[model samples]
Target: MTLEEYKKEFTEDDAVGWLEIDKEFDRLYPDQEPKHYAPPISYMLGGEYPLDGVSIYESKKQTDHFHFVTYGFSELYYNEEKVNGEFSKWGFELTFRLKPFEGDNGNPPSWAVALLQNIAKYVFSSGNWFEEFHFMPANGPIRLETDTDITALVFVNDPEIPKKQTPHGEVTFLQITGITSAEYESIKDNPGTAEELVNKLRENNPLLITDLNRK
Candidate 1:
């Protein structure tokens, strides 16, 4: 929306951005209730987690996996000062798709929740943000203490959720996909290899679901 248009519709307690996100997800999932995780206190009040919350959905695209989308990375609430801005807080929120592991029994793993929180903590603390094809090392197994080869991450735009422009700004759903140690090293060996690796992964796994069993 243009600045003039925004001014014409502005409200002090307007939750335009937040409601837009919810409306998109509601369209996708219909009547399903997603599993949501959030810290007890709000981040503005110095809560432990940087994100306001994460909502997880069971997706059957390509394979059965849990889809995690974050909140609090953007200007979720209304603010006249930021009307019709180009981008939200950092212009994006993190998303992840993880294949169901053994013993999940239809329940999304807790580690996924913790992983998002750690990523948010890093961004909120270091004032750094991630973008398409950016890769990072987890320093250990992504699922710590577990015998897994997925120890790193690479980002890409979420295939399912398209970017949306709200009254506050535009928000991109940046998806985080886990990778193996060999894959991580290969990216490091060749500075721009992450995009290539992600392309290869998409050949067989279009959704880029992070499978702990992957090697």
Candidate 2:
């Protein structure tokens, strides 16, 4: 659905601030866990020759960003030992540029809250089929804007797979423009008859989340 349509249906509460969608897939079918990778290290032996050591390491990364700021999460796996396994979490360097909005005089718009809730619902329902799903606002500055368009960065889990990714199972970045509470109320009262109005909003302020990446 269009952003304005989505906003009208869901943005009933003002307390809603941010929304995110996250998904999980079976990295391995038949209940097998994905293999972990290791980093190779070289060490000096007997102060003469160099020796190589193989060190086991986790093989995944997670990140999130809003408006030139970023936040990250962790991935953990349990081994047969039930105690020994792999754990990796990066709460580090990543960023995105924030678009300035006329209404955001330092205050976010009310629509942001509803948008975030809808995102959470979509992710939870779609990703629940996998083993687990994790969702959280990547700590940073995410705001609504009127001047620029934003899109989600789409990426593939396996680049070798050749164009398997559709507009699904990826991050969704939203852009807000020329929208106000009065306009929203008009659409709500009109229901399905407001296609022209919806199109106007879509034409004037496009909302898209494209270019999803796996990094």
lDDT of 1 at 100: 89
CA lDDT scores, all candidates in order: 0.87, 0.25
Clashing pairs in 1: none
Off by over 4 Å in 1: 2-4, 7-10, 103-105
* Model 1 lDDT per residue over 1-215, tens place: 77777767767687767777788789778888999998899889978898888999888778878888888788888777777788888889888999988846667888888898999899989999888999899999898887899999999999888998877788988999999999999998995878899999999999999999987
lDDT of 2 by residue, 135-214 (tens): 12322222333332222211112211111211111222212222234444454566443445435533532321111120
* Candidate 2 global TM-score: 0.24
lDDT of 1: 0.87
